[model samples]
Target chain A: MTWHVVTGGAGFIGANLVRRLVQTGGRVVVVDDLSLGRREHLAGLADTLLLQLDAADAGALAAALRMVPDGPVEVWHLCANSDIQKGVTDPSVDLRATFLTTFAVLEVMRTRNWRRLHFASTSAVYGDHGTTAIHELTPTLPVSNYGAMKLASEAIIRAACETFLDSARVFRFPNVVGLPATHGAILDFTRRLIADPQRLAVLGNGMQQKAYLHVAELVDAMLFIRDHADGPHRIYNIGPEDAGIRISAIAEMVRSRVAPAAAIAYGTEARGWVGDVPRFRYDVSRLKALGWAPRLGSAQAVARAVDEIAQQEFCRYDA
Target chain B: MTWHVVTGGAGFIGANLVRRLVQTGGRVVVVDDLSLGRREHLAGLADTLLLQLDAADAGALAAALRMVPDGPVEVWHLCANSDIQKGVTDPSVDLRATFLTTFAVLEVMRTRNWRRLHFASTSAVYGDHGTTAIHELTPTLPVSNYGAMKLASEAIIRAACETFLDSARVFRFPNVVGLPATHGAILDFTRRLIADPQRLAVLGNGMQQKAYLHVAELVDAMLFIRDHADGPHRIYNIGPEDAGIRISAIAEMVRSRVAPAAAIAYGTEARGWVGDVPRFRYDVSRLKALGWAPRLGSAQAVARAVDEIAQQEFCRYDA
Candidate 1:
């Protein structure tokens, strides 16, 4: 039996991946600092070792890895600062949490002689390369400090895979939304509407479009790529095949759920904020060619997330 | 007059760039930690302000940038851990010297409103892509930690440029060899042969090929690109148009210069070390199209570097 180790395993995507792995009867070990991750997200999982240690700390990471039962180990490196908005305000958040976390994890894996590593990269690595569909090979000219940090981590992982690891896969994820949602447009809209229930403020012109992948489908694609791909180092863009939904559409869905009469006021610029890639498309034909596809497109995924988050928040409010 | 800030100005490439800027009557400020840089490299330079500070320290970098006279500042970011061999032993050296140095410099640039930045990137970012001719758009999959660090820095600079800076150019250098040589095969061979005239132990098969560019030509091309290129973000591969000379050929050239009868013993693998990218080619037509070309091919550059380093070492030996 193989032991799967996940960093940032209490966060949104990491927690979701842990649940999928547990359901398949695999021994799982999760390392999370809980800076942004919630413990309740990983609750009720049987036989899962949740080591509450900062993944950025070298000593703590090594000790946590040692705690796993001696067996074949595969690392799912999903640890990163989830707050892209904060990266705009303070770039150090991305540097210390995202890039440094990756560096610490890679160092541990190198010392422990781990064979395979799966990195959770982001679509932001492409920046706002106009409105063209971006492939895995698109020149990674990141616009934000968050994107830069992720790209830096990707470069390190690629180098380490060649020098030390047996194999590695880097998946560039687009706006992932689902249960236990930490941050994104859907959650932000839901919170804002629940507060005022009248005028909802929208960033940008609300015409900026992008794809969104559900956390469950993201994990499915990750496992599928890991099992099927034989290349020593593989870079795949993970997203839905259909065109992305506009911000206005996502905002409307959120409005319908929380406050249908809320008037939407738009920001001046096309971008939501500094370093925001307002409109871009993902060419995930590489992953599709590998016999994998997302069940929900961007609109459907965002709609589902809005309802789930609204219900979660409403229940908490009622209690 | 515009103020020119050169990071790692006491090192080989940075010193060369400083020399060029000084010749053209530009006010120059040099920042270097002297970890891998030599103070003597900038000795007797006219009116050049030298600040002995680590480029990786954000506060120190900000202070140094503040010290520059109020004027249009264009930063030439060339600071990096020059020793690739050290990276193989410890990856943190590259992480600090290369990536963190760039990050610190960029942060300071962003805060201080320094709009123009010229980054010293490398061909190592291409990794071991066989013998294919690489272009600016070639997939960056660095095989060594040094390469990874450089690539990571490039990603940060790109992001920073899009976010804050006016214009930026990333020059991907390939084996820049010339006077005041800090480290490379030429200088290493010259010292070894000078110490022991009879035997020379070489890493990898002698047939491992790579392109080389004279540092003078590299600086020339960099200035040329800075002046002529109009792209918002420019990435150019700076190298000789000719094919790379083999290690055995360069070794023979060094032996002929210093120790005529030295016997060369080759290593088993095709690469010099674990992170070595033994063979690759740079398609610098992007640069060539910009009305600039290498004055010396790889063979000529290597031969010239061998003579210059041998003379410098011989004078030291005599003293």
Candidate 2:
């Protein structure tokens, strides 16, 4: 039986991945700091194997792994200061949560070799270079501290990968949506409509566009790359089938889906909040060559996320 | 009547700046963990207000600030884990020390605004863009984790400036050399020559060209900028007249000055070390426009550094 360790186990993406692993009869271990990830998310599975502590502490991480009842032959290192937009106001908070956390995981893995590690990197790593379709080879010039730190961690991991690890795959994911626990543009619109059905306040001049990829599709792509590729080093872009969708269309889709009576309001500012990715379109031929395409397009993914966030009482659990 | 605080103030460049600050009749505050910085560097000015602590610790920095006899404060935030080639080997150590430490300073500064702060940035922030003349407006695309973290800190500082503190000045300096106690191309070459005086093992093919600035020139320009500029924001390049230099020439210079009799052995396998700045020079006409330039050219700076290092005993003092 295969054993898997998902670092951010109680969070939206990690929990879903844990459920998937459990359904497939794989032994799974989860380590969550619970700052953002809720303990209730992994309530029933507490006995299944959980570590309730910060992942940024390498010692704590090692101690948590030692407590795991079963061995984790493979690792999905998704624990990070995962919020890209959070760095604008307080970049240090983001660095501690994301960059230091990444470093900690790398350090832990340095001593303990694993079958593979699937990193949940974001396309935000590629900063504001108004490109139509960017590739893995495109030089990353991050406009935000979030992207800069993530890219910095990736560079460190490059050196770490030099060691004899089985494999390491860095998946530069597009805006991933569709989850058991939802909080994103889709969810925001759904909530805004719920609060005031007559008006929706969207940031920016409504020209911001972002690439969307379902979390399941992203996780699947990550697994596919890890299972197939024998790369000591691999950097792949995981994105949706469509190029991307404009912010205006997403707002409309959110309005129509949740509150048909609401009027969409654009925060006709020069741009979205500081550090918001204005344009995101990735060339995923690298992953496509490995025979894996996202099941849902950007629009479809947004719609799905809206439905889930509106229907599920996940927000109460998230906050 | 200037009381200037220099974090990492005991480091190579920091010490150099401290020297100039003292020479110009300025009261000084030096903050250094001495992980790399040496205590001996600040020997003569034991009574000049020095803080021998990690700048990353909020408590420590606060204590240091409070310890300082309050005067009109002007801080030169020159603290960082300053080594690009070494960071390629282990990126996280430096990133945490550099990025997190700066984060602490920014947070502290937010509470107690310095009359003005001058940030000592680096040309490494540009990374390996293969460009000859890099500018303040040049697109930053760093190839190493060291550069990445520095660039991230820059973004963080810039954002803070725009919103939190708009008066901070950023000086992206070229490869600064001259009587550094800790590390540099000159230090590395000196150590290599000492280790194997018969043959020196260079990093790359000795062809990695870069703009070199003397620390004396850098600090002088920084002080000049502090005295003159009164704008919403300031970002000026401080470097030598020669925008670029081949590593081969640097190797030759080191050999001649430190160990002429020692043979030169090059690590001629590649164009650069793991994270060496292969190419990309700086244009410091902005500093020149301010009527401040390095007194010595790249060669002169190298030769002078060699003379100083040769005269001084190795591992004798801190910095």
Candidate 3:
């Protein structure tokens, strides 16, 4: 029997990862601050197996790790502040919560000698890559504080893997959009549509494209990399082809799902905000070469995410 | 009469700036934690006033700033973890003390509505630019955690200037070597030679190259930029004309200053250590256009620094 440790497990992607890990029949322990990560997010899944500990607090994380039952521990490090647009408004929160907090988790894990680790990184680290298909080797120069912090975390993880932990796979997620997440462009649009019901307000021009992946596909790729890769540490840009999604389409989907007659209005800027990427198309052929193909392209994934997000909101109406 | 509020006033660059301010007959108020800064570093500079206060400690900084009753305050923000090499060995220290500390100071200034700010930045933000003449426009993708933190600080400064503060100047300094009262490469080498007097262990193959400017020239550039530039914000890379100094040459200069029999040893790597940049050059033509230049080239600066360091060390021995 093996025990899997997942930090930020009660987070959007973390909870989804937990659901997948549950199916695999491994003893699972989740560590979350319960600040952004909710108890209800991991509701039925918690049955003495879940360990709710703050990832940013090293003392709590160390104590939590010690509490792990006698088994082979495979850790998944996925905790961070995942909002880029908000970073422009207040970058201090992003740097402290993301960079400082990530450093804390890395140091703690290194002390515990957690050999196997999978890091859930973000595509924002690449910034605006000139609409080319960005790969793992792409020179990352982040334009925003959030992206900078994520890039810092990626570098720290890579260094830790090279020096301390031998097994580390860094996955740069391309817009992991799905249901009930507190924040996302899709959720943001859906909420606006539900409120206005007649006029849909959109940030940036609709031409701003990006690769969006469903939560399941993201977790699948993560698991595949964890189970498969050997030799030196791996850096994978996890994205699907059809490579970019149009914001207009997401708006339309949300409008139709919530308010059928809503008119979409653009802010006239080419990009969403100062920190938001206008377009990001990843060259994820590396992951495809590793025997994993996404079930949905960017458009399909965004559509699915829109429906899921709307349904979750509608569930609130029923409540 | 204009008052200069020099943050990190006890640090190397800050002390140099304070000296210049004092000489120019400007009212000066300095704030420093004296972490790496020394009281002796700013001794006998007869003009300006000094306050022992941590820039990051909000209550301390606020109380110190309140003590400035001379005129409207002008900020020269120079405090930081100055050594890039130390960043690799001690990242956590630099990360908190440099980046986070800088942010706190900026926040305090912002709250005070301080008009003019001069940020003392480093060229390390450019990372390994591969011997190219890096300009202010060069894309900053730092390799070391220290560089990343500095880059982060620069980003915040830029934002504060553009969005928060009205007038600000950012100085991206190269290795500003000088006959300072306190510690530096020259001082370190002299002390090491005096201690052993037989064998000198220099880090790297000693091929690392970087632009060097006497600290006075750097301060002069800052004064020039402050007097001329009129806009939301301006940034200039301050370096020498030939662009840089060779590390091997600096070693020989230090050896020449010491007993000649001392053999030099390399760390046996192309780089000094993990985060060391083996080759660096700068394009400081912008500051040159602003009508200020370095009085000494890299080797000359090193020789002068070596002599000053030797004299200082000899005095200490006599004491």
Candidate 4:
């Protein structure tokens, strides 16, 4: 019987992961800062320990760890700076939220002699790998501070694995989307259309393309890797087999579902933002070797996510 | 006129770099905390500004930067946790010293609009690459906290370059050894032998082999890279052409020179320390491609370093 500790447990993908872990009859303890994570997301989960505290705070982290029974603990580290754009104004956000949180978590694990760790890294760590499908062995040269911090966190986790951790799994996630989606392009597009039914203003030229894995598929793949993957340290690029869908294609899908009458407009700049990697591709052959693949492609994932988020938000606003 | 800023300037490699910059008639500003740096190392150089401030302190760093004249500024980021062993006891040492210092420097640079940067990274960032001569594209999987912090610093520097800097050079160094030497295997061995000449206990079997670049060669390669390498960001492996010398061989050299009568004893472990990577080889072809090479091989470098350190310490003791 493994006790699962999921940081950022009340956030989007985190909540989905928490639900899956709970459904599997595993004892789950959720540690969240509530800065961006909402408690409402984890509602109705019984016999679960939910500690509202920042993972970067060592004392709070240690206190949260105390709640778990003395046994096999598997850490699913999901806490990170979700607001990638915020890194430009607050450079320390990524460092503190992502890197520091990981350090604190690894330190606690070291002291407690708990070993198994699952880190949620990002494809952004590869920065702009041009048009080539970045393999796990690709030289990670992150351009954004967010990506830099993620890469930093991954390095630390790898170091900890060498030093103390019995096993470690680092999954480089693509743009993940699906139900209970808190943020991203689909959510943003849907919200904008809700605000102005006739006009849809999108950032950049809307040509940016990248893979998107649904949260359900992401969680499923993670579990599959945990059971099957062999390693003291294993890094896998987790995404769909397809190249990915363009932002313009995603916008068309969102507009069709949310506001069919909306006229799409694009920004002058080709990139959405300063640090935005307009194009990225990653090879997921490693994960596929383990017999894991996303059910939906990038465009399909975006369409489904737009619908899910639209339904949830519209029902709330209507009520 | 080029105005140079070298963080950790009073320390070993930093001091060597400052000397070269001063010789070139550049206005050099050195920021050091004196935590491990000795002011005596920079005694002969005149017209050089030495600020007793930690690079990690944002306020102090900004205050120190104000003293420098408004001109062409090139930052040589060498400030780091000199003690790799210290990371084991205080896990935060490398993070605060190495990673935070780089972050603070980059922030200051970004704010001041400083465009040129030279970051002193380490080959330890490559971790245990087995016996292969690791290229610049070698997958970075740092095993030590020190190595992880260095890798983190490189990632941050690269990110900062992409965001702000016009040009950046990231030099991944091997075990650099030379005069005014503050720390490392040679200094440790010499001090231990000086304290007790009769019995010398070596860490591990000391089959631990690694490359050693002389401080002079390292400084030379850096300047060469700065002049020849063109890039928004360029990463070069700075070391000798030949594969490195083993710890046992280094121990034998030190024993013969410092204490011929000392009985050598070995630790049970194969590695010197917990995070110690026993064997690592890096290809210097990248640096060599630019017509740069180390004058001394690994064994020769170690022997010369042992002599230089031996003479410096013995003279002080005699006085």
Q: Which structure among the candidates has the greatest TM-score?
A: 4
**lDDT string, candidate 3, A9-30, tens digits:** 8889988888888778866788
Residue A73, candidate 3: Cα error in Å is: 5.4
- The 0-to-1 C-alpha lDDT of every candidate, in the order given, reads 0.88, 0.73, 0.76, 0.88
- Residue B36 Cα positional deviation in candidate 3, in Å, after optimal superposition: 2.7
- lDDT per residue for candidate 2 within A159-224, as digits (tens), equals 455443456788887887876653577777777787788999888888888888777777777767
Q: What lDDT tens digits, residue by residue, belong to model 2 across residues B1-319?
A: 6788899888888888898888888888888888888887787873366678888788778877886665457778888777666666676656667676777787777767654668877776665667668777665555566766666676666556544565778888777777654777777787777767788877677777777766777778888888887785678888777756777888888788667898666676556666666776677777778777777887777677777775563544332
Q: Is candidate 2 or candidate 4 better by lDDT?
A: 4
What is the fnat value (0 to 1) for candidate 1?
0.72
Question: After superposition, which runs of candidate 4 have C-alpha atoms over 4 Å from their true positions?
Answer: none
Residues B152-248 of candidate 4 have per-residue lDDT tens digits of: 9988877777678999899998999989978899988988998999988999898988989899989999999999999699999998888799898
DockQ score of the complex predicted as candidate 2: 0.17
Worst ten in a row by lDDT for model 2 chain A = A156-165
Interface RMSD of each: 1.2, 4.7, 4.6, 0.9
Q: Give DockQ per model, in order.
A: 0.76, 0.17, 0.15, 0.79
For this target, which candidate reaches the highest DockQ against the unseen true structure?
4
Candidates 2 and 3 compared by lDDT, better number: 3
lDDT of 3: 0.76
Q: Judged by TM-score relative to the true structure, which candidate is superior, 2 or 3?
A: 3
